[model samples]
Target: MLGSAILERRLELEVSQEKLAEMASVHRNYVGKVERGEQNLTIETLVRFAVTFKCKPSELLAEAGL
Candidate 1:
């Protein structure tokens, strides 16, 4: 649920998983896992993603249906 739209948003921004991971300061595999809904991310990771995407955390959460 959370991962799917995160993946979509990344694609909408034309960012690859590796690139998004780099931006978020997380491992590429971590990003992949998140995108695949294999990993449940923490608030810190969500914050990192929000920052990397230049959006509010609430926005990202909403987009991801979290």
Candidate 2:
């Protein structure tokens, strides 16, 4: 659910996985895995994504209906 929200935000922002990874300071492959819901994420990673997306982590979670 969070992964899907992340993907949606990425698409809405017109960024590729590689770009989002760079912005979030994660590996491109990791971003792909995340979008596919194939990996677990740390809270730190979630914060990083929120920073990269210019939103709050809670907002992201809310968007994901978590």
Candidate 3:
């Protein structure tokens, strides 16, 4: 569910997974895994993604309806 929210935001921003990885300072493959719900994210990683999307971590969770 969280991964889906991230994927939706990434697509909405027209950003590629690779680009998001670069922006978030994560590996491209990690980003893929995240989007596929194959990986768990730490608070730091969650913050990185939220920063990349110009949102708050809570906002991401909210977007996921969590």
Candidate 4:
């Protein structure tokens, strides 16, 4: 599976998957699956992630190619 730009950005900022999950209120494994392009994300979940990154959901979608 292709790695997500979310993963790229997270790594760029030196944030751990667990930490991101904590901040996003998501399961860590869900973040891992998302990073690995294995998750079919809901809008709410995407919003949680976008909020964690302090970015717009559309921007995150563009980055993630959703």
Per-model C-alpha lDDT, please?
Answer: 0.87, 0.94, 0.92, 0.80
Residues 7-54, candidate 2, lDDT per residue (tens digit)? Answer: 999999999999999999998799999999998999999999999889
Q: Give one digit per residue, the lDDT tens place, for model 1 in 1-66.
A: 779878887998898899999989999789889988999889999999988878988998888766
- The predicted structure with the larger lDDT, 2 or 4, is 2
Better of 1 and 3 by TM-score: 3
Please give, for residues 1-66, the per-residue lDDT of candidate 3 as tens digits. Answer: 899999998998898999999999999889889988999899999999999899999999998887
Q: Rank the candidates by TM-score, best first.
A: 2, 3, 1, 4
Question: Which candidate has the top score in TM-score?
Answer: 2
For 1-66, candidate 4 gives per-residue lDDT tens digits of 223778876887688999988988988788899988888888898888878888898888787565
In model 1, the number of clashes is: 0
With a 3 Å backbone cut-off (N, CA, C), the pairs that clash in candidate 2 are: none
Candidate 1, residue 23: the lDDT equals 87
The local lDDT score (0 to 100) that residue 64 gets in candidate 4 is: 59
Highest lDDT among the candidates is held by which one?
2
Q: Clashing residue pairs in candidate 1, if any? A: none
Each model's RMSD to truth, in Å? Answer: 1.0, 0.6, 0.7, 2.0
